[model samples]
Target: MTEPVKLYVYDLSNGMARQMSRQLTGRQIDGIWHTSVVVFGRETFYGQGISTTLPGRSHHGAPLQVIDLGETAIDEETFNEYVMEMKDHYTADKYHLLEFNCNSFTNDVIGFLTGGSIPDYIKDLPTDFLSTPFGAALRPTIDAMYRRPSPSEPTPPIPSPIPAANATPDSQLAASILQAVAAHTQASNSTPNAATQTLYAPIHAITNPPSFHSFLKSHRAAVAFFTAANCGPCRMIEPVFERLSEEKGVKADGTGAGFAKIDIGVGLGNSLASEWGIRATPTFIFFLDGKKLDEMKGADANELRSQVDLLLFQAYPPHPHTSLSLPAVQALSLNPILFTQVPAIDTVLTRLSSFIDSNPWLSTTQSPGQAKQTLTGTVAPYLKARFSAAPSSKLPSATPTLLTSWSQATSAIASALPVASLFPLVDLWRLALLDPSVGTWVSSFPTSSPILLFIDKATAALKIPDPTSNPRNYLLTVLRLLSNTFATPALARSLFLTTRAALAEVVIPSLLHTDGAVRTAAASLAFNVAAFLQKGRVDKVKGGGGHAARDNTLEDEDWEVEMVSAVVEALGRETTSEEVVHRLAASLAFLLRLSPAYDTQLSPLLDVLQTRAVLKRKLTKGGCGEDGVVKKDVRKLVEEVANKLCP
Candidate 1:
């Protein structure tokens, strides 16, 4: 049975309890003077002040009336710990006649237990009291008498110390608040890789098939458990169901499987379960793409868990590729647009003003930066001359010489110019690589190639801080250059044929950065890299991201899969900005194209996208209809990507 949380109103004064309101409202009110809450079924009641209630009636109150708050999901042990936590904060000596009293305590406890809070009318009583003429007249005296007690006044009796050691009340409420926050953090970390948030992810109580079916169609996999309140077997298996809901299986995006429960005893739940032909209590069903994959009945916890686990893996198993080898990849080419020089570089520079000259090196001071003026200046353009002089058709054969020059120029400019100032040089080099001929030239680099060495030097700059410069923006420009260069199937497939672990290592961590632009760039890079690795296999499955729970994974680790997993998790943690959602969505769509199996990995993020306000608004808003398009916000982009992933 659900416990009833009752609010007990009380009268502090004997005869004047009913008459006290005459001063304020000029009307007769009841005996209500003070208040506390009582929770039955837990065999415990709670209130403010240094006192306790033994399950039922309180020593302080007969009561004017009782108002039911709501039920709590907190178990006995956890509730008791919270009770003690509240008691320590509500020490009698700390209670003020107006400020820190029973009402404030009640609001805090009720809010913590359930997300619900006590009525605002009850909470506003103190402020209302102080606003009256009688209250104003007596307030100073009341303060002197009750607020910490004057030196000569008698003190309230202190409660006996708790039996536990280190039981001193935190002097500051902020300390208790901090402890509460830490406890929440500890709880979230307790269930590793599981969607153990207080708010369940992808878990809904469905009442009808049309609604449920729509959700099923949108996601890669879903697990529904048919249960009833009165069924003992259902009760027994509920823990197992909840555990699986929390455990992650496929990748580290904080999703195990789509989890939901429907009680057949309830009105809507009954029809839905009956429609599915579920006649037993605790019937567990696994679904993929709106089709039933497996089901389990009775209270056999192990079998139920195993079945779901199996489906989770089978639905989206890892197909790791140590190296990519695809004929389509080898036959790839680049767009003609990349070969065209950006004519707006000087315009952008002129707009940036004197800041560039003032801070020659945006983020790095390791180099002298004299070469920046020469490179950015119009008089002596070393890079432009060489790039223009070299024929675009002969680029494949000519790249080594260009690479040698690029390496020296990069080193010289890196030391002499701000990281931001290298945009022109990096930009033109990217444009040069757009020539279809470079595919042969790029793949020709040996492990001993100096070009690989320059890659390391460039990567180190990723970690450098540039407060004035938009590092993410600059990195975005660089990443686009790299992704475009490898957009061709042949060049992307080169990952499998060679050892380029250095580039992958640097790229993966960038996906986890807090900057939306950086993450967007990183995600774009992942999509480009993923195209090189899928090897033409596409399947769907579900997973959560963590070190454990390796399901159906073979010997060859899919480094691309792991990187995508990190992206899924990062998207879950991201809280700010719309642009990130745009880039992240773009990345997800690309990953989906890379492999249909990522639907399992990308599915749980939908829950996050729906719940978080920053991301949610992107999905919910729009004057446009169901068929209408949304703005180019991150969440909107994510929705588009979701369609691509599941479709």
Candidate 2:
């Protein structure tokens, strides 16, 4: 279920909110002091920092209004990741009582969690106050009184009728200043270290940027390494330029980054480069915050590297540890395959014979059930041949050719039969794939593997919402089986880079599906796929010791984060299936193991203390039957894994 978010309005002065406002602004006003937002994630509730409700911190009393902002689309994990990202920009030192305050922080946090912002009324309050003549007259005292101790340390004044009631000097001073300003026509007062950081690789390719204006604007700083074709020094530094690209253009952790490369010698560059007055090779133009910081001409390797290095730091300040590696990742297995649980075909077929055999030919039938039955005899054999050990002696088509055949065959059959008619084929496909001989042979097949195309079709087949209605469940099972094939390193890399998104589209959302079985399958699919993604990473890249495997990954993309968030949120719920819960836990473990970006330092998957407590309670509850015992065991294991991974 989508989680709820609440915007908490704090008056801070108990019942004296109106009096305090009148005393501060010399005008009757609505309750306005400090505001916070509490997000009810999948599992627990979270507030910006601390609220008046916090123990030993009740000087501000209860909130004036706890306004429900509707359900958030992102799950808790994604929200937490976003919260960490905001912490990067919204440190206490950045706070200004009037310019950048708790309210701004609240807006950024909620914006990341839900695409929505703080209420229009609440946002307009400060702008309204700042625009007023009386507010202007008292601006100096207000600014002086509420000045933040430091950029990262916010000491926003708590509005109260009597400053002595709070027993805090800062609050007292702020109240007095507000009161004095209202009565007077006066003016007002005003309000990563380098090294331990990492640099994302820069873009090194010689190409023109799409929308240069937007590209430079996106990064805090960007360098356009313009080079000429005949430049010898340019050739000498080509390697360094590319290395710089990797360091500054990509991410420190390699999720993704922002930077670019352009050559004036090119067609489009002819005009743009001339506009910039670049006539030399290896000319480096450095920009910070969309304005030119500096430029370099005839700069040697040392000079170019140093200048770009500085630009990179400005563009992407280094974070000490954004990445993590696990050596045992490749050893993780994809099984136990769900196909083992497939029911006997003959028994199910006998029961459905009436629904299917009723219409011998699909051309006249409107029912998917009946149409499906007719194609069973024809397409089943074709697919079985595709998967089976025996040779057809027809000289099988090339991988791409096979894809064309598969697409044509499926399209034709789908037109006549219900899509479910082709679902059973996956069962045959899984069994044949399990055989080492068949799996290896398929992997080694000629150029342009057809498995990629097959995956695209298989995912399209299971796109239906209702898993229980047809054999769509079987289709999902086949996808799990297909994940196993990627264990072959070559196949794993190819699949993850090319086919990961297609399967991800099928797997991630289904974790939140209403059907328990669907959710279980989805979680299992994620577990296997994430495991495969881990196996695909190589030890080293063209550049020294750094790994380039994840440079092109889409894992950190917004949609991907949202998907993982949904998965974690589902895990926090009261689940019915032990397998679902187990796989969900396993999937999170895989993700944590997959990258350090998923680490607790940035964003913990859950409130470790609370998640562990919940798991412990379930363990103590004790199971009775076999299923119950398995559930209990899984509960304990998940708790242990979560404990290790979260910290």
Best prediction by TM-score: 2
Candidate 2 residue 135 Cα shift, in angstroms, is: 45
TM-score per candidate, chains pooled: 0.33, 0.38
Q: Mark the regions of model 1 whose C-alpha exceeds 4 Å error after superposition.
A: 1-399, 411-421, 446-455, 464-474, 495-520, 534-558, 569-583, 590-618, 622-647
Candidate 1 Cα RMSD (Å): 20.9
Across residues 188-301, which tens digit of lDDT does each residue of candidate 1 receive?
123211111212232444434544554465446688889877899888988777667656322223234667676675424566787889988878888976799988889998
Q: Write the per-residue lDDT of candidate 2 for residues 1-647, one digit (tens) a residue.
A: 68777876664334454655565555666755456666652211112221223322333335677777777777767666555434443443333344445565565455545555667666556555655555554445444443334547554443343436544543454465455432221111132111111123324222223335444544556777777667787788777766666454533222223444555654245555776788877787888777888988874777776776656544443322213332232234544333334345544444344434443444532454433443355434444454445556662322434333433443434445444554444444454444444455555652333355446555665565555663555456546556555444454555555555666666765666666666766776677766654433222221212323345463544434555565566665634667776676666655655353654332444453344544434344332123342544565556555455454
Model-by-model lDDT, in order? 0.50, 0.50
Task: Give the top-scoring candidate (lDDT).
Answer: 2
> Model 1 TM-score?
0.33
Question: Residue 330's C-alpha lDDT in candidate 1?
Answer: 26
Assess candidate 2 and give its lDDT: 0.50
